[model samples]
Target: MGGGWIFAVIVVGLIVAALWAFTKGTPTGRQAGSGSGSSDEVAQLRKNLRVKALGNDALVNRLVQAERNRMPGASEAACYKAAIESWERDNR
Candidate 1:
């Protein structure tokens, strides 16, 4: 029963990755100017990832520590991505 969240997160991650890959090269998908718009999107993505891990305290802790040990900024995304990858690996 507890493993259900892992499966859900994996599915969600895959779907998101597919959508990103599909749109990455499109004209509309390519945003310019290095604006805060992309930063907002990244922040939201990290929030959603963290929320998905909420049901598992251990996972959340690992992500938090991972971020702390990493650089002060641009680390949450890496940490969350690592957690998702580890879930995919350990469960298989």
Candidate 2:
């Protein structure tokens, strides 16, 4: 009976520890975009786009313009491409 109690306590402790580790160490932010690409690569791509266009405000405005110009049900990729094009046009 004592051994059983010891085992139960150990199991509970382990469960608590596992739960704490899982929750405490996990990232709490927007997930990275899907694909085989590393997060660093995706972040770098976003950074490059911003740098190429000057800043986030410009990028966002361009995205809004692209959304307005897009057909209904346009893919995100299409919108992003349009935003890049608009940014290039305006910045140039």
Candidate 3:
């Protein structure tokens, strides 16, 4: 009976270890950019945008132009609004 209990505990311990290992494992380089499963593209994009907005005039111009292109009626006020929205979304 004691041997059976020891075996059961070992099995449970192995199962838990396997679960932790799988959950904490890193992906391969190709899998990193696959665009759907477990990717960090959105987070990276947000980080890039924030850095650009904070430090680069060229990037800020490009971002503003992109926003204006997407919303033809977007005024300077609208651009500011969109920028604030983007900032809030990322910060939160």
Candidate 4:
């Protein structure tokens, strides 16, 4: 009975810790700020890759425009990578 209470308390403590972490985003190497914007860029990149993989020229054009709008300063290497990935996916 005592063990069960201890286990319950441990579980509750873990739950509270998880909630706290969720509310307070985990710290990373990036500066104190720049969390949300970086995450948004990553999310946009993921969406761009998926859309590019669909292998429609019109859609690809739209992806390019959307990406430029999202991050005009983004590297050309990223664009090349998306194209290569799309070609590979389409070929496969």
Candidate 5:
């Protein structure tokens, strides 16, 4: 009788774990209705864009400096993005 109870508990535990895994495998996971994505989405997008922009030219310090000078009120990130956009335009 004790062995039967133990077997039942193990089965229940396995079922719970399987359910948890299935839920996690979903596209949105636990945040189905949430408008915002995972916290890293913005950071990942920035990194990916930066990589694409710099694919042809690794040395863009001068361009970034020029962009910063053009937009004195802009933040460093804004200046960098502008420089990348300029680079993409000129290269193409």
Candidate 6:
């Protein structure tokens, strides 16, 4: 009976570990080292827009559009500016 209990515990532990591993597989899509449109840039823009938006959906949509229109090889600063412009345009 004790041996059976141990086996059950081991099986449960293995199942839990497997589930954790599966759920933890890989992170977000953005890669920091991917260059040209790094995660940092995207993250920074998100942060800035979040702050500017102050929980407004309209501003959020503008931010999304800005990010969607982001060009390759564009710097984070440029992206930020563009996003801001989009937000401002829509805001007013």
The global C-alpha lDDT for each of the candidates, from Candidate 1 onward, is: 0.55, 0.54, 0.53, 0.52, 0.57, 0.61
Candidate 2 lDDT tens digits, 1-92: 89999999999999999877643332321134534335563354345456655687665656645665774565444444445556566776
lDDT of 3 by residue, 45-76 (tens): 43445563686757666665676677887555
Model 2 segments more than 4 A misplaced: 1-45, 61-65
Q: Write the per-residue lDDT of candidate 1 for residues 1-92, one digit (tens) a residue.
A: 87999999999999999887754433223234533335564554455445556666676677656655664564444555455445445555
Q: Give the TM-score of candidate 4.
A: 0.32
TM-score of each: 0.34, 0.36, 0.35, 0.32, 0.39, 0.36
Clashes of 4: 0
> For residue 44, what is the lDDT in candidate 4?
49
Which prediction has more favorable lDDT, 3 or 5?
A: 5
User: Which candidate, 1 or 4, has the higher lDDT?
Assistant: 1
Lowest summed lDDT over 10 consecutive residues: which window, candidate 1? 25-34
TM-score of candidate 1 versus the correct structure, residues matched by position: 0.34
lDDT of 5 by residue, 15-49 (tens): 99998875343322222343333445434324534
Q: Per-candidate RMSD vs. true structure? A: 12.9, 13.2, 13.0, 11.3, 11.9, 10.7
Task: Summing lDDT over every window of 10 consecutive residues in candidate 2, give the lowest-scoring window.
Answer: 23-32
Q: Least lDDT summed over 10 consecutive residues: which range in candidate 6?
A: 23-32
Q: Which candidate is the best by TM-score?
A: 5
Q: Who is ahead in lDDT, 1 or 3?
A: 1
Candidate 6 residue runs with Cα over 4 Å from true position: 1-35, 66-81, 89-92
* lDDT by residue (tens digit), candidate 4, 1-92: 89999999999999999877643332221224443445554444444455435646576566556645656675643443344454445666
Candidate 4 positional error at 87, Å: 41
